[model samples]
Target chain A: MTIIANAPYDFTSNDRQEDFRGAMLVYVGWARHMMFASPYCWPLPPDMPFGALVEGPMAQAFAQHPDWEQADWSTATWTRNGEPFTPDLSKSLADNGLSHKDSLMFTTPGLDGIGGMGF
Target chain B: MDIAVTKKKLGLKERYALMTRGLGWEPTYQSVDDVFPMDSFEGIKIHDWDAWEDPFRLTMDAYWKYQAEKERKLYAILDAFAQGNGHLTLSDARYINTVKLFINGLAPLEYMSHRGFAHIGRQFRGVGPRVACMMQSLDEMRHAQTQVHAISNYNRYYDGMANFRHHHTYLPYLQVPRSFFEDAASGGPFEFITAIGFAFEYVLTNLVFVPFISGAAYNGDMGAMTFGFSAQSDEARHMTLGLEVIKFMLEQDPDNLPIVQKWLNKWTWRGVRVLTLVAMMQDYMLPKRVMSWAEAWEIYFEENCGALFRDLARYGIVMPPCVEQVRKERDHLSHMAWCQFYQARGTNNFHVWLPSKEDMDWLSAKYPETFDQYYRPRFEYWAKMEEEGTPFEAATPPQQCQVCQIPTIFPVAGDPLTRAEHSCTHDGERFHFCSQWCQEIFEDEPEKYVQAKLGAHELYKGNLFGDADPTAEDFDPMAAAMAFLKLTPEDSGLHSDSRDAANFDLWRGLAKANEA
Candidate 1:
């Protein structure tokens, strides 16, 4: 007879656009290892629909944002547990199948590199 | 004649009793041995198949109907979640990337088990176990389907979930789980059970499932939780099968204990090494916290297995000797292994998904001996590099462990900095690697890991350096695949990297880094 959401609700909400953007940045940082850390970067294999986030139209669509830089990820903007980890972005370069070059940026929350817990 | 009273309609349990215990007919023509031959390969002998106890004695009519109902409930949950932009409510779109990692790295193995259990279903001489496996075979297919469907909701929101069976060619993390299953499936049924059922499902399932459920719960994605819980409830049954099968073998003969021990050691460590991603996922991947790998290992492996083995030891089956080694590794491995992922050239990064200091300090306190003593100081060294405007430079990974394919981040078992990364020579040619695990696996069994004449980066090394061929035509992924599978170059097989076949090289390479 009781609903989980309405049961004396007290959980925090990320309702602001800034919160959403910040969360995105934190996720971007969380994904830092994904870009440069794997043998071949980009989250999925090239044939998968998800791989398009890196190589195809969506990649281009995101690339339209001006805020991103080739090394924007490595720029020490946030900290975790007071121990800083600048998403070792060297993986993002697209040159020589080594790093990424796409410049995709979004506005608001600065979630990337917020120390131990990025979000 | 007086009419006999009709037999009372049976409840589920009574039906389970009749269908399982009474339905199987005595073979009029063939002996049980003639019907099944795989039981003796690991030299495990069972005196009696009837003695095997199956707690969930599912009969066919009820089995099919319950399975149908479970599926109906599962699909409805998925539909409601998708109809809702439940995707956006998730911690972030990137969390879906973690789910993507789960699918590419882990899902195919579920499908493979569908075939594996089908074999076990038909081949087990015991009617009880065979029937259990038959139901399990069906469960495996449903698991594979549900896993894909659960993540497909993110196909529009993320990139990694799409056409991923083919993604093994491009993503190295994906290659890790794929190659592991490929090797397990290629081995005998006994090895498959050791590698999959015991090592993966029984020993490692809690560590995996806990993070998975919490990830769904924290992100507000009920669909994943429903699917995960369904698959996991079935997994509880599979774990029982693993334990029963192992005990059945041990009960058959005393010699079976040693063989099972070796398998337990090898697969346990291998499984743990691969689960490093889940380690990072629990520790750092989620925006909200989940149980740490250290805590999970303590409860799942230490406490549970400790008790299980204590029970087994009474039968003269000693506990797995490697338990202490595993307990030690769990302390520093998530940190070390995640670093391997962070530092390896083609591995995934832990950037945007960093955890908090309270969590890190908690990590340090929990793993005081390992973290405070070894890993923390080491990261400090790297931090010094980044602060000096020169985050420490990484070298090209040695080609040998390159077979294991993880960076040399894992130091010798006890020493974190000794960096014993080395190579061996076969016929005057040198092979290099980052860790002894990778090197020993590669050198002791070269045919196991090496696929001859391939490297996506090879042409650039030779005359093709100037060709501007965006397609990586020359690289072969067989070695990479072997490394991923806990196999090495010394052992030769059709799928091994040592194979001379060109198409094998091509497909194998595609399976690794997706070369054209």
Candidate 2:
């Protein structure tokens, strides 16, 4: 279980402050942690607790970035199958029905109202 | 009584004029723009219609006579192969899956090519390009018919060969190639030429035809080899048309370069994406391999097209933007795509098998960097599972790309094991794509691609296999899916490893007997 990171545009990395932008990022082959990214991003590990996924490397990557740290996390919305994600950060993504072949999206409030970075 | 009449033969220039310009007439009542309204809509500016050149200079009579002769020769070979029991001469019955793929996937596209070219032939104002399109239309028809006639021998004894035309339209996997050609056919004339003639024929035809024909030769599929051989000259002509048309368009107006470049980028990626079937066939399906998929890509595409791009730089045409990803993924695409096929073989018309130890060794030799490390273990896992009496099949269909309609099996960058997923937010509904190129293709024209009937998406909506129709009483989704695929228990059904399994056992038995 590995995932490849292919972004069609240049976006700041969630965990790494390094500017990651290209049509293809890196071949993330054969990994146990897999999730789906839409509008161009990488799949994250679904087995990890939702809190770790949000507050862990992913959130840290987006949080400490020079340009993106100003974004407010309180206005974020996560949904699975059109239902809003519950704030029970203790549950693993797999426990919440975010498995391989399933699609999930996370969006924070943005000026455009379509929200901030989502996938 | 012998009657002698002084008959004069038409000179080459005179014959060309009479055949092309002689046959065409300007509309007396309508403006030329009204007569050829569809050609200009794509924003390609053709300043001079007469500037479009036809190198072949073929006329209707000559085209018919030459094509008739080609058909005659091809049919003779087909008949001889059938009467001589050529099926027994093949490397193995498993080898026919390659043939099945060609018939089921590519042959119908030839017919579509004919229809597309015919549409363009009628629409273009230039007699030269128009005649060339007409000739290509005829060539495509011949290619399609010859491919069917050649492979018709297999339909005689095989189960899956019976209903390919039906499968091509309705089957989920087939939507990959079907939607590609259908998109081309529905475009304006200039875009149509760029899509088929320039992008497909000029750039990628060799990648598709060469491997299959070489495999046919290596595997002793003489009937298929003959048809492939007969179709080569026409392919060459089509390639010429492709190159010529691109040059013509670029040279016609400076404004045309960007439009042609856009089509070049889009169709080049689309054409290569459609060749996933060929990639799988070359790597996994062929019993006696002719060449590794990577090697073929290097020799045919990387080396040749690199030079082609350098030549086109003068006209502001660069290599396709997707070429880098294509080169990087060459080692992985076949393995990833084949794994998907192996998982979904129950739904496919072909059989699947794990690489034999010898075949694995060959793969290791061919793919020194990646095969043993990444792909081999996956095959071994399946082989061991099969040995343990618990075979693997995906419980559900994989997510499909909205534009290409292929399963999203491509590996993510920096990680080959974890599959990469890409999508775009269009109309507030998230649409998934297989790659950046496919995503851009959809984004460039959202209206055309938004309506894609992806197999996985359709299954989710219960539209697959006519399940969307609530009025039909017997439209059980499962039963309808099976019925539409023509996969009955006794008739056209699933192909498995039993044939190879039996052959291996027989070989071992013969070896033991000789030793004893």
Candidate 3:
């Protein structure tokens, strides 16, 4: 039950425990799912303050925002071995249980942002 | 002669028993291990071969009669479809692209299954299972041949419909399926049975076949529908064999449970990964969508897989690993794949385009939660660019997954512009995968995947088009790529802006005029 920190920009290190392979793969799929849906969420206008919210509230806000349209937050209710995982987006992915060495499933919002399915 | 003629006809049970267990006995000349070396390597223990049950009890004579009758009916429909110019009746010309995907991606895998089942039929020690495998081997061959015959009708009118078997061998996108079957075929006997017999046939074949048939029925392509219908009966038998094989292996010994579970996980993921093509076809290619890929996945996988896992729980097996990932991905995969094809048509052999406004609305309705929000803008962006006379197509090939060979376009969840690249160092060389499952697959058997011929690597190393320098003025990478595929512009890869788009517009214009 060791909890690893998340680092969105880094992927050099990842969890390789034999027992965690299945759950780790689930997280990887979630990472891809989020990246795919990120384009729908436009960058906040320059002066707006950036904030992180729990997935339940974020989903509601996204649904109401006509511009955001039908964003999928299925993976936003993230799970670790079928248990719910809520990470703080305000901090680096490492603070949220994603790390370059152990877990690589977060996004660095400004510098690299997210790479898309469209190369 | 008169006395001998008084013998009665053998009943079904007696005939099957004699044909199966009646012929088997312990061998005196060679050790059982020597006789069946392939079975033991996987650590599957079987105390008695007689315990195997031949479920079909289908003799060669009955098999021929059953199959030939079905083929006669299918060929009759195929002949009608061809002779009546039924291609003209499809929902749209773009509908043929779905057929193209089928012929190129799936048909050849059927042929490969034929070879796989044949090999395993000889490899297994039990006579009952051997006979069943032999029957399934023939069924697979028939599926391949009939699929080709049915779709060959399109070859007469379409650009990318020709030379499917050849395309499957060399096409980059097609490598997803080719590598999958090759992995299964090259494995031990039990692995092959579970990989093809169980995971592929029983679990995932419906995802592929159902969409095509229903899509055909909706689009008025009787040829494909007929071919699919003809194959369905045999598919049921193959699926039964798959289920029976798994249950038999599990029931035989407790030690066999974990190994079988591992195979179930490996092959289930592998098979589902390949179904990315079907998902794309169902969601994007068909002119008349039968169901969204998400809904189909829910029916075929989530609901069905839940029941299947419950049944297997008694044997101490859970669901295939990471299947929840597949459940989560159902809403997103088809759209992602369709967008990838639209953007990268230059590197592929199929036609793709931005969905029409109506089609987009339909998608939004079908995927109410995700489409308009996450996927539509991408399509809108592409379509707007096209309208402004600056259509977007990739100038360079995207880096492909080391194992699956798909491009690195899969999104990292929550980030639309960035995708995940999972990699590992194997034998001093770095390898990349599109997802953790593929990466883990490589880690598990680095030897099996290390030698894969990635398209980019091949071109960079000057192994293509007679080793000509990639920088030479006369050298064209696309041409080099096509040269390896034996494809020419006339009858090969269909371009989105080419005749396909024009024909679709033409059909739409006529429909509009009729409506007016």
Whole-model Cα lDDT per candidate?
Answer: 0.55, 0.71, 0.69
Query: lDDT tens digits, residues B210-295, model 2?
Result: 87687888998889888987887698899888888888988989999988888889998998888777888888888898898888
Candidate with top lDDT is 2
Give me the displacement of residue A56 in model 3, in angstroms. Answer: 43
- Looking at model 2, how many pairs of residues clash? 27
- Span of 10 residues, lowest total lDDT, candidate 3 chain B: B488-497
All models, DockQ values?
A: 0.02, 0.04, 0.04
Mind giving the per-residue lDDT tens digits that candidate 1 earns over A1-119? Answer: 11112124333221211322211110111222211221221222212332233345333323322222342332335332122333233233232131111112222234332132211
lDDT ranking, best first: 2, 3, 1
Candidate 3 residues lying further than 4 Å off, grouped into runs, are A1-119, B1-10, B25-28, B413-418, B467-473, B490-496, B500-516
Which regions in candidate 2 have their CA more than 4 angstroms from the true location? A1-102, A105-119, B1-14, B465-476, B489-516
Quote the true-contact fraction of every model: 0.01, 0.02, 0.01
Model 2, B20: alpha-carbon shift in Å? 1.7
Report how far residue B203 has shifted in candidate 2, in Å.
3.2
Candidate 1 on B361-422: residue-level lDDT in tens? 87787777776655554456545545576443222221213343443344445654333335
Cα distance off (Å), candidate 1, residue B364: 3.9
TM-score-based ranking = 2, 3, 1
lDDT of 3 by residue, A1-119 (tens): 11112222222222232223222111222233332322111111222221332243233322322223333333334433223556545553334553221212332222221234332
The candidate, 1 or 3, that scores higher on DockQ is 3
Binned by DockQ into CAPRI classes (incorrect, acceptable, medium, high), candidate 3 is incorrect
